[model samples]
Target: MEATHRVLVVDDDADIRDLLVFVLEQAGLEVSWAETGEDALAKVREHQPDLVTLDLTLPDMDGTEVCRRLREFSDAYVVMITGRASETDRLVGLEVGADDYMNKPFSPREVLARVSALLRRPRLGAPSEPASSVEEPAPVAGPADAELDVGGGLVLDSARHVATLDGERVMLTPAEFDLLRALATRPGEAWEREELVREVWQGEFIESDFLVDVHIANLRRKLRRAGSRTTWIRTVGGASYLYDPS
Candidate 1:
């Protein structure tokens, strides 16, 4: 049977830990608390929590290092909580692979909202099968569709919704995959933001072009991890980003 959805709350303050546990449990999630980075890692190894709320100031290891190490082992969503609100702090956390951050003295309600959003956000490449069960679908061939090789040691699998880099699977968000496919499919053609909205997003729901930028940034990071560059996408203006095959 699948286990209950778990959240790991890592903070040195016992009161805050208990409070988070109570709130998260009330919100319908299993909760585990750790008082230090080492304990947090151990809990992650033991329970494999679906999400983690990490305190930046750890007694032993720093939160940034903890984040890097955790990413090495799991793809669990991490949200950084700290008293430091410097832009540099936020940037470093993100650069090291944190998905979100919250400042200390934060409202419990806000914390709960962020937790729920992180847990509910749809992940790309997630198994369509029931949770904890492995189901492999039979491969179905695509029609005689045009193939465009996106070099940089990457291969695109539009049919299977997969992307591999140097023979290793590269994980991407759904929006990232959709953006990459849309840009790469046309090779040399540059796509304007509105065009991408109509084509990739299938609607004009996104109000700002930053939506495209955000997804492109995420996609570029994934590609870089695969030892490649997004030399394909070019920025025409604040409103347009184009794809260049070469």
Candidate 2:
């Protein structure tokens, strides 16, 4: 039998949590729900879900922190749901490594669609093979000479989705690593916000462009925490961003 797609739904609101569990289960996915970030993390480690629907506001910890923490272990897909409509919130969520975002009072259908799109995305950071699967494995970093060398001190195992900076392993969520690789792989190319959204988030379409900024901010924070330099992702005009390999 084919493996079931497991989804972890995290929200402080009981109604929203239950509603998502019902809707996602009805859609044929194996669903689990958590009322807090701590609970969500425990369940995530236990179940190892295929995808996650996370509310930006959680009781124990903000959704952004949750996103950062999860990246340390699992490579599951994350879609952040926020009650605030502020650009800062959207940007922050993305920066913390969310794969996608949805503002509150959102349609269950839209939420379902985003979840489906993310789930359908090519299985990232895996070796390439036949093209029959719904999502292609993330492109590998092989023996190419022309590839951006972020630094000889750092090695990114793209296929396995791991990064080692200065011989010490650092943790990143799948989304975080993808963002880093997208920027680092090119090294000096100026990647506009729209370009990052399209390239880093290839499967699903982001409705608001500001979402890119939030993710970039989050990526910078995490990389900084890992003691890696993020000067490579240069911001331009408060509108666009680029990667400087130099």
- What would the TM-scores of all predictions be? 0.65, 0.72
lDDT of 1 by residue, 121-218 (tens): 32333422222222222212231133335776566665445578777888754345556777776767777877765555433223236446666776
Q: Give residue 48's lDDT in candidate 2 (0 to 100).
A: 93
Clashing pairs in 1: 190-242
The per-residue C-alpha lDDT of model 1 at residue 102 equals 74
lDDT of each: 0.66, 0.70
Off by over 4 Å in 1: 1-4, 122-162, 171-222, 225-230, 239-246
lDDT of 1: 0.66
| Residue 203, model 1: Cα distance from true site in angstroms | 19
lDDT tens digits, residue span 1-246, model 2: 133578899999998888888878776778888989999989999999888999989888999999888877778888888889787787767666677888778776766666665564434433322212334234423432222346746666665666676777666666666677777767766777766756666444466366666666666666677786646578877777776534
Off by over 4 Å in 2: 1-3, 12-15, 57-73, 87-97, 121-152, 203-208, 224-230, 236-238
